[model samples]
Target: MTDQTVPRKPPRRARGEGTVYWDKRLERFVATRIVGYDDRGKEIRKRGSGKSRSAAMEALRLRVRDYERGLAPGADKTTVSDVVKDWILYGQGQVDDNTVKTREFNCAHIDAGIGDVLLRKLTTKHVEKLLRSMVATHSTRTIADVRACLNSAIKRAMARDLVDRNVVELVVTPRGTTGRKSKSLTERQALEVLTLTKAHWMYAYIVVSMLVGIRTEEMRALTWDRVDLDSEPATVAVWRSVRKSGDTKTRKSRRTLAMPDLAVDVLRRRRRDQDADRVKAGADWKDTGLVFTTTLGTALDSANVRRGFRSALGAVPSVNPAEWTPRELRHSFVSLMSAGGAAVEEIAHVVGHSDTSTTERIYRHELRPVIQTGATFMNRFAAVDVVAPDWHMEPLFRLPGEERTAHA
Candidate 1:
């Protein structure tokens, strides 16, 4: 019998070298490269394909370069969804509960749009498109928050060597829908609101907020120990808040504010009301020590305060209850104090701002009119004063020996 020599397929390329072949099934050229080895000594292959051999070779070179740079190991299989999940898992303990919830909400938008894209393949165009989609239906603030979340998530991924770079940072965020500006009630409107809330359960809350300008979180977290009603000047120490950490928004925000007579009276009444509630609740009361509490003495949250505020506004006829918020009470406080001629520095101190710039920026509308009071005061002594009955003025350029005289 004649031994027929069998034709064999070409030997496989060496370890470091790559190979190119025509893919009959896809009718395209395919390139495969051995880029590196894993810790377990398994060969890591980087693969690419294109319609032409040159295109496939170019793609292979790019993939090998990405591997050499440690750009997202196995990125062809790793989607943006995977990277975002990794980031969230690693960051679970870094932020507050509210911030985590906000991040989660933001991530929902990212996942809905481009989460399926490969992490290393993500580009500025993808991020920009996501932001534009958000702008179409969301407010500027909301869109900005989404952008921030994606940026932070991708930044962490890059730090972990899961991505070459954060493409979200390269995208220019589009302008989104403008949100409602903060506003305060007029003097007459404020008085009406105060009068209407007199018999409501949130009377002291509304009164102290309007008078002291404390944040709702500060007010809700206020405790009896922090309030000094027996002192020469009744005061409330804004040392804590209803935040998960129980800390104020900033060091400046943790302050002591002297109570106006209205606030003092309202607080005294609220103290008595709370005592009655405690007696009624008996063992059922939570005893959280919060100044603002429900019938069971549990601390009030933002939703609780918002609902109560809107209910109180129902008593006033001229104001649209839906348009106003609890925060407007603080805005109204700034307005009232400005109208009463309180200096900007004094207002900033009372509201616990670190500096006047914050007060100016946030309460510019509520600030007293900058009507050139300096000009008016200086005009009183000016030689060209329009209101002066006498019109005589003397020139100060007389010679050394010349007698000085007033000129009319």
Candidate 2:
């Protein structure tokens, strides 16, 4: 074969010939040869791709590096574990609590399981096996969750060059069951809850939550400038959501949410209460600018809000319907609004959902029965002659303990 390597005094060498020529460009040993090139119409020579000319010449001299390594010249072999750690650091500091929870679940359950393995050695079999083993203890749906987590984690690993191939591409993940729709209060039940809440210390706070359907975090982070009671339509700008850390989670979540009429009225009363509170804390109260706050004027926590909501809930006999959560009140509000002939799109906009589809998907179960009376009225009307045609007039109808009844 023609020597395509750098030109030198001695050019011809066998495959295993241990000969090296000093590279004039870099003054280092390199396997050199002169070969004719069509591009320049003359003999050309250049150093081969390697760590250095010396290493390239050594590989040619030994003939061991002739075969492709199937890898690039410079690549780090980071373990999956190291890559996962970097991912966690890059993700957590800026995301909301909900996002943090999702990523944490992926890292702990999926990433940790295969993190120590070499990224290049990861294969489709490993992914399938991990999914299968997870299926034994978890339901098919939960196993699919694991699969999604693995796919996400591997995606990050691949972009960072930690893995040669992401095995998630070859595996087919099972579709999983979804989250349930929340339980909502009926119209009468909602009225009773509203009436009972008026007597509580946190009555206004409770009203703001139920009527507005603002998330608990968003409600707690409300501020004075964010509320415009004098505006023609009025509005409550939900610019921030409180976190367990007692801080706003993200800048985007701090949106200006407008208020409905009922919400506006409730907030008006709440502002009056806040004015009185500010007077009492006078010198002691730091002007936190927070619209909803504790007696001391600091921002409120979700636990405290739920604790207050629960106490008021106990007074409402109708709230005894079934198992309930504070978050479900948002569902109750949306359901009440929909049942009142409000369109899904209207509710979607009022609730600050990205779109109608999101509102429909997230709150489908909460939609109250519009035609519930149909079944109840029919059952009542039909009960007297419910069964067979003309059989009501038949003498075959029997009373309790009768021979006919016993035989039937």
Residue 2, candidate 1: Cα error in Å is 21
* lDDT, model 2, position 356: 78
Error of 1 at 62 (Å): 4.2
Query: Residue 18's C-alpha lDDT in candidate 2?
Result: 44
Q: Each model's C-alpha lDDT? A: 0.85, 0.67
Off by over 4 Å in 1: 1-63, 92-98, 369-373, 376-407
- Which pairs in model 1 have colliding backbones? none
Candidate 2, superposed: residue stretches over 4 Å from native: 1-77, 132-149, 175-181, 243-261, 320-322, 368-408
Candidate 1 displacement at residue 170 in angstroms: 2.9
Error of 2 at 154 (Å): 2.5
- Residues forming the 10-long window of minimal summed lDDT in candidate 2: 66-75
RMSD of each: 6.3, 10.4
Model 1 / residue 198 / CA error / Å: 1.2
lDDT of 2 by residue, 1-408 (tens): 776886665556676344465667766566654432558588443334245656866545322232133232222345666656676777445556676676667567556577776666677777777676665455565667667666766677656544556777789865334434467888898888888778676777767777888877777777888889998778777766666554444443345556667778777887788788889988878678887787768877767777877887888876662366677788888988888878787777777776777888778976543554687897888875666454533366668776643222
Q: Pick the candidate with the highest TM-score.
A: 1
Tens digit per residue, CA lDDT, model 1, 1-408: 669988998677666658889999999999998777899999989888999877987889877887787776566577888877776778666356778888888899999999999887888888888899877689888898888878888877778777777778777778898777878999999999888879889889999999899988788889999999988799888898777788887788888888989899888999999999999999999988877899999988888999999988889998988898899899999999999888898899889899999999999989985556788888776646566676666766877898876555
> Which pairs clash inside model 2?
237-257, 238-257, 239-254
